[model samples]
Target: MKIIKYLLNSTCLLLIFSINPIRAQVTIGSDIEPRNGTILDIKQNSNTGHNPNAEGGLGLPRVRLVNPNTLTIDSDTEKSKYIGVTVYNTGNAGVPEGLYFWDGNTWRLSVSVSSYGNDGQFLKSDGKGSFDWSTFVMPDYKYHRPTQISVLKSANVKPESYSYQRLTDGGTGSFGGATPSAAFEYLYSDELNILSETANEKYLFIGIAATTRTKTINNNVPRTSYWQIVGIDIDLTDKNGLNVRTLQKNQRLYKTAGGSDLRSYVDLFTIVPITGVGKGSYTLKIKVYNVENTFSRNTGSEGGNFVTTETRFYDINLVDINFILYEDD
Candidate 1:
């Protein structure tokens, strides 16, 4: 009877143990069970009920590393197991103090610290995975002058044949007339060459100064002469035939009327800024166009009584032409 009783108690205890399975999880600072799939859970004590102002933190082990490239672990087998290990480094032996991690072969700095750079210096990436402090560099300014100058003048023809009438009983006429003829001519041009060594992403600043002189003759009837720079174009072309033209039109130079043997001179100055230029062999060209109006008119009833005017372009001189290159922002 005593043996049966002892066996019955043992069987009952075994049944109770089998019904409630044992867990390998651990929970600290609280009596609650550890979360599912978690081997260890740590939190602040909740003895005084849940407190919103609870303060708790986990601190990593601090160490002083002599060199980040070399690991101090003597056992190669043990070092392999510390590939993902991380620690806070307290500066020592020239190594900066920061968070570092073992990257299988060496320890690498995990954070960029301001203490690594001096004042007014910036941390720059090496395009790889490394960074270093670098000093700021200012933009450089370069100057270039025109190498060649040329002009394309109008054909030596009568003033009445080349020029047109500006005002009459009819109405206001077009500046260049019906079609672009000798009346509108390419007066002047300046060329500048940019070599490959000086080609870069920059701003091309162009400064031009030109002077023009004109002569007009007035008969018995009222006669007038008008001549001006109708257009200014900058043609930039590369070796591969990439062309870009920046043009300004109707830039007046001179205008006068109703005087015999009348001579007039005018000066023109302009500055053009061209941005976003790329690296290449480029030809910088400036083209200036001349437009004039000196047509003859018949005022009297007879055809012989014709009022004819003669106008001529004495000179179109380029006083100064300069090109400057500035680094683009």
Candidate 2:
């Protein structure tokens, strides 16, 4: 197998890309030494919005912020009003008069500052901004990271249940036309079977990778350094207030200096049990925080807030991972 080794020197982490030339399949169940470095988060907000019904209350439902010093809002449904409001620094830091209400009785919730006696800073939603939904506006968010690697075996093998994709033109194709020297590739996410909520009948697997390159067909290249992953938050109830994990320690492997760099490829696979997740669907989140030397100081910033150049925070590419229910398994 042929190998390409391009050593880089910079705070910016660069992912190595290669395509081997072979037509046989190999399975890798062992852990490879992942690239070494520190992982950090670049904040992001979910456009899909959170569920307010999950947290019950008449007025503002207490919401957390990505940074305790950062500002955020949380609201709920009241008697006849479609809105309510709560404000905090996500750090549990309180802002005087930060929390307000639009009783819908005295005001229409849309009353302009001119119409209603205005307070320079007040929470007022014209029904467009406010809903019976729970929303968390975070300052720091991280997406998932996807990697492409080739496995070698003496013979051919069939892929199990891991997700796989081929390199084709605008039209899609399978693993037939690829040559040993060509960069034929596939993708898979171990978390692809997970979901946003937990349901006894529901199951999912989530696989995240870097964004696809337009010029390099079938080549996995990320434009930015980070992306977003949403799954079972594992540590919290709501999917708000982001939590970041770094795989910067993942091992790096490639074909050595004087070898053939070619092989057949397949999707990733894993074994999991279906039990104890609760009633509805659960969301699992994995995001790329920053791709740098990964060996920088202050890896886990207690500040969690990205304020200085030292705070390696950036967004990577991400896609929602899903798992469906099966009749027989």
Which portions of model 2 miss their true places by more than 4 Å? 1-203, 211-274, 289-315, 319-322, 325-329
Candidate 1 per-residue lDDT, tens place, 218-301, comes to 232234444444345666766665675464634654445444433233334444444445444565655444444333344444
- The per-model lDDT (C-alpha) reads 0.51, 0.26
Q: Model 1: C-alpha RMSD to truth?
A: 18.4
Clashes of each: 0, 67
- Of candidate 1, the 10-residue stretch with the lowest lDDT total is 153-162
User: What is the Cα-based lDDT of residue 242 in candidate 1?
Assistant: 67
lDDT of 1: 0.51
